[model samples]
Target: MSGTSPSVAAGAGQLPGTGRTAVVTGASSGIGAATARRLAAEGFDVVVGARRLNRLEALAASIGGRALPLDVTEPASVAAFTAALDRVDVLVNNAGGAFDAAPVAEADLDSWARTYEVNVLGTVRLTKALLPKLRASGAGDVLFVGSTAGLVSYEGGASYTAAKHGVHTLAETLRLELCGEPVRVIETAPGMVRTEEFSLNRTGSQERADAVYRGVREPLVAEDVADCIAWALTRPHHVNVDLLVVRPRAQAAQHKVHRDPPDRTAAR
Candidate 1:
């Protein structure tokens, strides 16, 4: 469907996102934070939520958005966050991470639990809580910041992969359930994104995290994924971008990634 109708074109402001309200979770950093900034620039009333209130407040102040403390894992936090908002035209579910990369044989149960708790259960909790508001908006969007791990599997990433897979299915199921409704379920699966804390938190050390991208010439950054998200959200309400998989030029697939030779001189 075309986004440029005469009525939309004749609207007051230059931005298509004018008069929309967007709520982005996990907005303390990475893609979530970048999306908050981009949506604000797009003229949407942005509200950022995260466990880190200080950073959220700073981001809110910078972008003229609101900040609310949210821990998706906690029912109370999700309720409070939901209650604090009067309108929500878009919900960006981005609060998730890979905690460990242990193989199945050597899997740490605790790590597995945490992975599922944050990436799957927590996401569901928040989504269910805010779905009523999203439905009330009449033209709402639920966008999940999924990962390539959800699509394909590799060695030593079972915990993360499984959780992401859950996220992928969650988006799909929601789309089916919301058929004929105005809300759109979109999933942006990014591959090899090098965020400040993603690798560090996954590997548990700077050295190991550095090794994860040792020879990669260019890895996707948070902003790249954020751009995809904004583009999808700003599309015509009738257009539903079911799934968008984004990766850097260096990454062809989950198993295949092009990398340059290690820079020995830089290491020295």
Candidate 2:
């Protein structure tokens, strides 16, 4: 909002600031990890947040950044995280998950609630907690890693989709509300990103996880979305991408994929 900002294609990177500080939630892995690295390489002080202490710490150590324990679902955790941080230039809320295989009729409310808790409330909790620091930093930027599910609903993603929709709405509202101020709110919706733990974590089973992406060609990699994020966050002061949708070339929309034909002779 105030101090520094990026390039025409963001290939050149963001503005130079020795004190460029950023707080990235869900920074333990995937897009978060990639972004943290990108920012660190750019000379910014980075703070990585996540529930997995070992992973978070390792990531933080690897990037030479600070690590903070944060669970978006927990207020105390979020509060502690933000309270300790100062001079926040960028906020990357990349903490959301999708449950892969539960049918709507057999949906478990408990799991569904957990999904909402971490996906929607988690982002809200962390964002609100850090607003003061973000605002004070002058160049306050809040970026949410929403999903294409928010834009398009699909099978077996009831709760996840709902939470993402909430994220979309939140980003929109915050953009309008914070427009008068220095703060900038933006959201990126990724289609199907093949991250390390996404499938296993989402399905709650390793075997089932493998089946989710069975035979889908060239799924979107975490770096793909991470690169988009790096590019998006580095935009100039007056230029806000606002909303970006990124997905695999093979996938046109949520729940739709271009699969290869079966090997009839080799298969059972």
Candidate 3:
């Protein structure tokens, strides 16, 4: 994908946020928050959902959308969240993370289960709950904020990779199953993104999180991935972007990445 960011309209409602409503999970920050803002700017009534009510409220206020407290891992929370939404034209499943960086032999079962619960089961629950609404839109879109890990495995990433692989499979299967329906299933897998909380949450340390992109000149930002999602959603109703794998130029693959050398090898 091109690194160029998609331009937003002049002002809010410049394009449409009425009539079409988008529900974004994990909208408190990172990719989810960026997507919620982008969709709102594109004239979609945006509902930002996350367990952090305060952050969601703040984001909602900034984007002129609604805020709903939601914990995707909890069935009751998902039900309550869906109950609050009257209609949904777009659903962005982005509430997922890596609990611990451990190899399979040293994996923590709890972490593995948590990863699956949040990444796979949670996505399934929300998708099932909103299927009717999506079908009703006549051009509904279901987008998953997957990861490069979903497409490729790495050392000490068994749990997260496995969970993300499930996400990829889920998206693919849903697209096939919903072939005739108006709903579209799209997945955007990003690599080496430097978000504020993603790495911190995964590694549980500021130092490690900082080290993730220490020498990388330009890692993919959340907005970059969000732009891809918005572009896919705005396409013709008949067109469906099945899967989009996005990574910064420095990151050629899941295992291969080129970092600047002491700020002198930046040109390389």
Candidate 4:
């Protein structure tokens, strides 16, 4: 029944995120790493976590934050990661990836299971483990790095789409369940993001991954998504950004993409 104080409100001399701790999962590279860096610049004490301790440590050092090893798909890893944190004001659930792009008829059950385990189950595991800390922070944020695949179905994308759909619904359900709580549940669904390993990991080949974004102009990069995440998290505690959908200018929809002619592009 209370609201944010003027000193902590937007336009205050001190940044809204100052003194708070933000935890970003899958932060070794790509969006997670970008979000962690952006949040640190926004004045939050950042903690970067991922299975890659080397990368995480390097990133954490560059940003003047801390790094810890975390594999959300493993329960023991999740437990250890959660136990290591003393306080968490923000949780960015970005430790997810698509394994394959096969069609539903030719679905790889192993791929489907892996997709679900990382994107859906892993997110849930970390979120559930950190809810208490989030609630305790008084003004907490839980942001999910979702994909446009969650909003619609696409050919050869059922496995990833299904898992992202689960993530979308999970955010919705948590928001409803935490109606009166101080914690905010937010989801940022990005379309056609050109990250380093996302498509490469999904398609299993550099050529196939390159083909996924061969045309048009600039696609959304990890920094673009990270900007959205930081903006949403920095708003006044009472203002909850429920969902944000971002896409490249060349992308009109899941099925509608504007690609320039190859010859014209080459000429330019």
Candidate 5:
């Protein structure tokens, strides 16, 4: 449990994450990819899974871990992914994203359904499929990469908000249901993350995505969230972090973000 740790978030420099197998879903880019790399560096035998086989393979090669083609929204794909693993010490459910930024009245049902299917049900499918392996491992960990959208609602985030809320509920219920089990269920809710795909995919344009973080100072990056995940996972087996909500200093809330003036002290 000792190594020359990379510069990550607080507590990430502690004991290395050795003698474990960590499965990271949606590891093609953003937070998922970063987490996979960080965990591998921490000493876990990492498994990067995503629908994009090429990206997955490349990431796996760079990290010296294995790659599996996985689509969490598809049961068969999840089953196949599960079959590839004989042991799962950690399952990082990070395969979810927002679809659109429309108001509830104008929200597209298809978009909403996609959001729910990927965010809530995707996590459920993987967690259920890997439960036995986790239990058998004796120090199993299930970590969900949730969002702040789950905690609060916004004007144009009805679909994503609802879906993330479901994720929150799922994590909470699973923890309660598995109270006596040896596994630990943890959730990390990040806010205002400036990933290339998240905002771009939601708006379907580079302009809109850029606007999401324009003039914002030091918005949370994928690496920041990954650091948090690694820190939580590396803790002692008895310590279980139920839910961790992280946000940048400029992001006070979903609606109360400090957008104007760029800096509060600038006006002074």
Candidate 6:
């Protein structure tokens, strides 16, 4: 907001990252990574955050964005991310994931707590820490990558569901709370996506992750979701499309899907 970017720096304040500053968390892979690339391509100087420095470095180098090794679960790391950025125009809080899939009867407290720590608390911590910069910048946009899981429940996904629900609540409250500010808050909730890294990161098993989507057809991809985010961000300054839920044509809800079997006989 308050920077000498030579672009919005002359007008009625520039967007946080417009030719200057943007901060994207959970940017190692998937939506976060895509958003960072999209923002950089949009001419924002993007800062990427994640626990994996190597991945972060590679992504940042490839896109010409800066990388900050951030573990959102830690207060110190969040503070550091905030300290590292000069002024942020867009804050994409996309650093979250699905954790554990055991039934309530067999759930462990550790996995449950970790889910909140990353999804809910991680977002809250980073958002609060960067509010000043967002407010300082005249036109800042904050996009949270929520899920349909936050809206609907799936079997054996109680922890992830509840945590996602918390995120949904957070986004709604922020939208109302920041009503008069120049900042815009948007929640992009998508149904099942074909991001291979999402499943692998959630389960820590590539084989298992592939098996989960082995037969699924027409799942949403990372760029598809990124396209939606880019569209929301480039909208008129007076418009705020607060909550957007996107799913593949085959997906009706979290529990609904249509799959076309691969052609085995066609190979013959």
lDDT of 5 by residue, 146-245 (tens): 8898999888999999999999988999999999898999999999999879999999999989888877778999998998998888777778889999
TM-score of each: 0.95, 0.90, 0.92, 0.95, 0.92, 0.89
**Alpha-carbon lDDT, every model:** 0.90, 0.80, 0.87, 0.90, 0.89, 0.82
Q: Candidate 6 vs. truth: CA RMSD?
A: 4.5
RMSD of each: 2.7, 4.1, 3.5, 3.3, 4.2, 4.5
Q: How far in Å is the alpha carbon of 56 misplaced in model 1?
A: 0.6
Segments of candidate 5 deviating more than 4 angstroms:
1-15, 260-268
Instruction: Specify the poorest-scoring 10-residue window by lDDT in model 1.
Output: 1-10
| Whole-model alpha-carbon lDDT for candidate 2 | 0.80
Per-residue lDDT, model 6, residue 139, is 80
Local error of candidate 4 at residue 59 (angstroms): 0.2
Clashing pairs in 3: 16-43, 17-43, 17-44, 17-45
Write out the backbone clash pairs for model 6: 1-137, 16-88, 16-89, 17-21, 17-89
Better of 2 and 5 by TM-score: 5
Stretches off by above 4 angstroms in model 2 are 1-18, 262-268
Using lDDT, rank the candidates from best to worst: 4, 1, 5, 3, 6, 2
Model 4 per-residue lDDT tens digits across residues 1-268: 0122322433557665788999999999999999999888888899999999999999999999999999999999999999999999999999999999888889999999999999999999999999999999888889999989999998999999999999999999999999999899999999999999999999899999988888768888999999888888887787888999999999999999998888876776
Q: Using lDDT as the measure, name the better of candidate 1 and candidate 5.
A: 1
Regions more than 4 Å wrong, model 3: 1-18, 263-268
Worst 10 residues of 4 by lDDT: 1-10
Reference-based lDDT, residue 6, model 1: 19
Where does model 1 exceed 4 Å of error?
1-12, 264-268
